[model samples]
Target: MTSDGVTTSRVVADVARELEIELPTLSSRMASSFLNQIPALQGDDAVTQLVVASTSSNLSTVIDVLQHGIPLHQISVPAAAAAHARRFAQRELPVEALLRAYRLGESQFVQWCLRLLAARSLDAAELLAAVQEITSVAARYIDQVCEHLVDIYETERRLWGQRADAARAASVRTVLGDETLDVGTAEAMIGARLRGWHVAAVAWLQSDPSDAARRVESAAQLLTEAYGRSPLTVLADDHTLWAWVSGTSRPRLDEQVLDRALVSHPDLHLALGDPGPDLAGFRSSHREALKAKAVAQMSGGTTARLTRFATVSISALLLDRLDEVRTWVGRTLGDLARDDEAMAKLRDTVRIFLQTGGSFTDAAARLHLHKNTVHYRVRKAEEIRGRPLGDGRLDVEVALVICRQLGGGVLMR
Candidate 1:
């Protein structure tokens, strides 16, 4: 052995002899106190094993540091940390609980060390050196173990989350696909039934469509919370989530629930499908949400974060013959299709006027305008089109409806 090794071995042996009687009791008390402080460390065999392994490894590290002047890096603390973290990950325990337990153990160990120094009645100079040694070694050990464990925990957690997500996505694809899979089997896989009134919703971010998958999950979680039930959720991509809320008795989509969800997540864009019954409803609902999403994009929907397929069904179907619809709108509205504040205000007046069945008084009340203002806009609209309302009342109403739904797309403005 080298001279250094011989000296280290002698010093370690001396300290071991001095603490031999107290070491077992000290370790047991420390472990007990740590577990008491972190009850999450109990209730599982894997957790118990991790606690035991960590306590023993930490005790060995501190003793070696104080006695042989061995470095913290040379110890098996990293392996212990990795093992403990793996156990926590497997048991699906929050990493915070493990970290809290470690902190508790650290405090208990320091308290034990201080008590030992006081009981031994060391001189002032000896006490100072001992205190310095305990503090330095304890700090280094705690920091090293925590750092190693945290890294391991995060890495393990990310891998686990990715695997779980991939598995769920695959199952959802199977159920949504045309494959001849049994509903029960699919339910077992996705943890939700297909035999119920299902209202499917797709959520995404407008700024970054690629962020769809992650943002969609947040949107789905918000929906689940508002509905007061767990919904079947699947990430269609990084920026899109498809989810369904169901009831045994066909339930209608509650507007208030959707309103609350939108209020909470202002930036989230949600497209919802009409509720349908049974497995066919499950497929149709998602299909309808997809259609609604497409129409919302074309219409330049402002304040349309929550687009319902039922509400947009007419527009979504009309979008199929968009070229023809645009031509018809141009012919019917003529200069009324102009994109400006004045034209927009005029169009609103005409729309409300027609909707109220040519009642100028009602249109004025609805638009919060005077009766003269509604009458003036209608005459102006007719003059711009070069025809009276009687000549093309049906065509004018249809054109106005198209403009309202398609916005600038059909208006060519």
Candidate 2:
């Protein structure tokens, strides 16, 4: 080492040793004062205790750095302070609260240093140089510590957020994956009971995945308010949310209220399950809600946006066997699926015709088409299929319903 470097090290070691002698008194005084004066650091809570403990440990580390001649940046203060900062962040303490404590603690440590120098009765020249060096190093140390702590605070904050989301998703998955709940563990995780009637829902963003979770959270809160009961909500992915509202009675989720919510968030789509009671009910309801969501997405219309499981149960079950369904649609609809626009008109006419018990006038009125046009399309449709429409009315009606619900998209190979 250079001569100047050796001399500086010797000087730092001597001053550090002297400071170490005062560490006990300094730590006690600083703790008592910071706890009493800084409201942020003054509680009997676990986090507050952590703050007190970290303060004392860090003070000793500062004194050791001077005694050992270690570079301030190389010292352990930043890492130690960062660990404490993460805990504070988790406890929801404000960053300002912690920064304020550091400022106050630095003042106390400097005062203690001045008192220690005076007690030793150092020569005026030596004391002046020591005070200057100590103050300069302490300032730099605190600044570095604060910088590192802030970075760690932000990083840990994001990590904690992700961890919380993962945990919540896992808990919700567990509930839906099985027929029974762990009762205490599941309830503790979700803050809701599984022993009551539950109306489950699956919601998703139609596009723009950003802010999807915010939409899900908003929808969950809306359900909570509308039902007058708390809900268990979990974001299953960036685009999807699974939620269930609980009550002794079923939730109606009034149509007007749903319409208002949809108006507020046009990109959001919701599918609700029929209410069922208890643990089995919770699982069943969620499954149905998911199925309803699938059918709604396949159906492709604004009216399908807020579908209920009870409305689409049969179609949803059929859609579960999609390959078989495609075959059935091909055989039954035959050539009716060929002309997209014309096929849609004929299918609608047939659906309404069958729905009205085969009244051509009523079918035309419902479709806004001429009665002759309905009859002509029906005959044309029958000719294309090479079968009389009345010979297989029931089969044709079912095929038409599937065509409407699943859309031509599912029929195109």
Candidate 3:
């Protein structure tokens, strides 16, 4: 009998007997087709024995038949067995499969290596040999996957960076006073969220936007390290850097930190703002810093420092309105001092008189004259200037401030 016919008959009989079910006979064509599909099967002594034994009535007949000579363990449906083998070979699969697992693009080189590893179970040397065998195919895939991975990683990093930037902007806005915000509301918003206070020392490098940004970033890193909490944020303007610091307390911030941080770059001129409680204070602190920077610039020296807005008084600001004050002064005191030195003396006397708490005796003592002389100077000065030095005490005070700035009195040039 043909091998396929014999084998089918044996299997059907054995199964029917084991389950006590009625046997269904297989047709010759169907039996032959099934047998032909088994891999490595040949008409040999072992095959003949298995077919004969499997048809017997005993339960062990099927087992004994296969044990005659064939390796039953190795024999299985080729397609199903191949699929099972592939599962075991997954890790060793071609580079293509590896790329797929890693979400990389297709590459023939990787796929060939996987196939070779599966077919031969090769070691490192053999694997390298397999890789070499498919070099052209593998190299292309490797290059493609590598490039794709880099692009994907960079894209993801940029996206995350944007997210971080947005968060930082929101944090800054919340700290500063919004249109609907009051001092109490601003304080409450920052109270719990902020850990400390800090002041940022900002400077720009030759008006180059890139260099300015780098300097700001470098200064921020240095400050962060020194204070262990303070961080700097920079706002860019032409030839200017608005450096802001955030920390818990101004006193707690270490000046030495800034000294060292700024030491590395000589090109930067740092103007430090007051330590802000949170980012909201950045605006105020920045404003103060800009004024301080202007003061530093006017001083014509690098070491000049101004930390507080109060250091520069409103009087100083008024003095800055010199052009406007000049017109008024010229109009009021025009030619009054040309002939009457006494008139000039009276002007100085009136300033002293008001400054000394309206005491004639104190004014006389300050001016090194008798009290009557002081009173006479004030009356004469008021007559010449054509203005009463009456209860316009506020105007007198303001005028005195301008006089001092303009170097009026005996020192007038």
Q: What is the lDDT of candidate 3?
A: 0.44
In angstroms, how far off is 136's CA in candidate 2? 60
Runs of candidate 1 with Cα error greater than 4 angstroms are 1-163, 179-191, 209-215, 225-228, 301-303, 390-392
Q: Judged by lDDT against the true structure, how good is candidate 1? A: 0.71
Estimate, for each residue in 50-80, the C-alpha lDDT of model 1 and write its tens digit. 5766777677667767776777778655456
Stretches > 4 Å off in candidate 3 = 1-177, 182-202, 206-210, 225-228, 237-243, 276-283, 301-413
lDDT of 3 by residue, 223-259 (tens): 5655666454533322334445554556345657656
Alpha-carbon RMSD of each model: 22.1, 22.5, 37.7
Deviation in angstroms for 343 in model 2? 1.3
State residue 328's C-alpha deviation in candidate 2, in Å. 1.4
How much is the lDDT of residue 281 in candidate 3? 58
Poorest 10 consecutive residues of model 1 by lDDT? 1-10
Give the candidate order by descending lDDT: 2, 1, 3
User: How do these models rank on TM-score, best leading?
Assistant: 2, 1, 3
Clashing pairs in 2: none
